[model samples]
Target: MSKIGVVLLNMGGPDSLSAVEPFLYNLFSDHDIIEIPRLIQKPVARLIAKLRAEKTKHYYEVMGGKSPQREQTEQQAKALQNVLGENYKVVVAMRYWHPFTEEALRELFTEDISKIVLLPMYPQYSKTTTGSSFNEFERVFKRFPQVPVIRIISYHNHPAYIRAMVENIKEHLQSWESYFFLFTAHSLPVQVIKRGDPYKDQTEETVKLIMEHFPEVSYALGYQSKIGPVKWLEPFTDKLIEELIKSGVKRLALIPVSFVCEHSETLYELDVQYKSLAESLGVESFVRIPTLKDHPSFIEALRQLVISSLQ
Candidate 1:
């Protein structure tokens, strides 16, 4: 049997208490992820990273200074390996966190694997997010002649993926009259959109498909997690909530479209902060559908992505 590999891609989190600075530095250093020219990129990255580290450290502190994504990614990888059986080996490569992409790729390369299918943890296709990681993987993989081939799973209007999201949302659906379906995703700077990044558009496509699944529901799209002081995708999540309140909306159903798993942005920002803000604004109820974590349908989606790429 020809040896094949599935290298999972993620925006990694800090592995330990002390690694936070370097981890954030590595993340902010990526021009694809945080594009500022070399003139001030280093100084700017260092300054923001230090500030973010302090604030972000609190979320990690709550989770014991670790992201459950590592454990979850491992579990998902093992399950996928089982589904793929002995035909392929599975591994994870995080962009900034522990079990870095370099480490994962090095290990897989040693397994004599040729050609890899990059199953990014993100469902939707975004140039900055998924594409950045994919590009990096390509750059690194090119160094090894034996590992010349790579594939990226663009994403997720797949039936299995849709089914997984729908099922998860269904479980959390609260009985309310005319709920606002807030499709939330991580926001990118407006400048990037002019460069044709496609993150916002990709997110819109996912929300459209999801709202299609529920024709009876009235929905709205909003962007979240805008870093620094620059314009982002409009109708920000916080502003949208306030707007909805003015429009006499009392109930909302929020979904984090850009994320595949629950993290600080999802748990703290959305679940804790946004949820409270909604309550304060007289929004009757706000329910967030959980991320697809070890869900059977999502597992099948990952397997299908890999197997199809092989074909």
Candidate 2:
């Protein structure tokens, strides 16, 4: 029997404080991310990375000098490997950091795999996330044209995925009488949406599906992680939280809808920064639900998706 290889794609975080600057450089250097001319973008990206390195390093330090994204992704990989058994080889391909997508593909080419499946951990489709990684994979896979490949770009509204999210949110909401559901996803530049990127659409759909599962709960969707001066997706999470406080929402639950695993964004930004802000705003019962991170339901979702794709 021909072996099957599965490649999991994600935007990786810096493994150490010292690697933060270079990680940022790589992130901004990608044309799919910044969309600037290569000649001018490289130098500008370098400057931005250097200027932001210290501040970015502080966030990493707060999260214990490294990002748990790689570790969480590894756990997911192992779980999938266990389910798929001996014939399938699972590989993690992070876009911006160690175990990079290109590097991972190069290494996998040496294995006895006959076919490859590209499954990005991102549930929603985004040019900066899934598109960027897919582009890199295609570029590298060109070197080995003999190997067949299949790709699962997005599974945002799959029933099992929605179920996993519902379960996680309910777990955090236990015993809370009245609370506002703050569904947050990483913001993208407004220009990207204008260009017809389906990210905002898909993200909204995912939130909508999850919202449908619990009609009794009041919820609002917002975008987070806005960088630079350009406008991003509307009703930013921080601003929305403030608004919710003014509206007499005391108890709040923040759900990271875009991320499936904990990273700097969730660990530091949401847990630390947002929690502090919620406390300052006098909001009681500020709870941030954990990312999907190796949840059995999520793993089963992956298994089902892969098995269907193979057929």
**lDDT (C-alpha) at residue 231 in model 1:** 83
Candidate 1 lDDT over residue span 240-269, tens digit each: 888988789877888888888777788788
At residue 273, give the lDDT of candidate 1: 84
Each candidate structure's TM-score, on Cα atoms with residue i matched to residue i, is: 0.92, 0.97
Alpha-carbon lDDT, every model:
0.80, 0.90
> What TM value does model 2 have?
0.97
User: Which candidate should be chosen as best, given lDDT against the real structure?
Assistant: 2
Candidate 2 regions with alpha-carbon error over 4 angstroms: none
Model 1 spans > 4 angstroms off: 142-145, 174-178
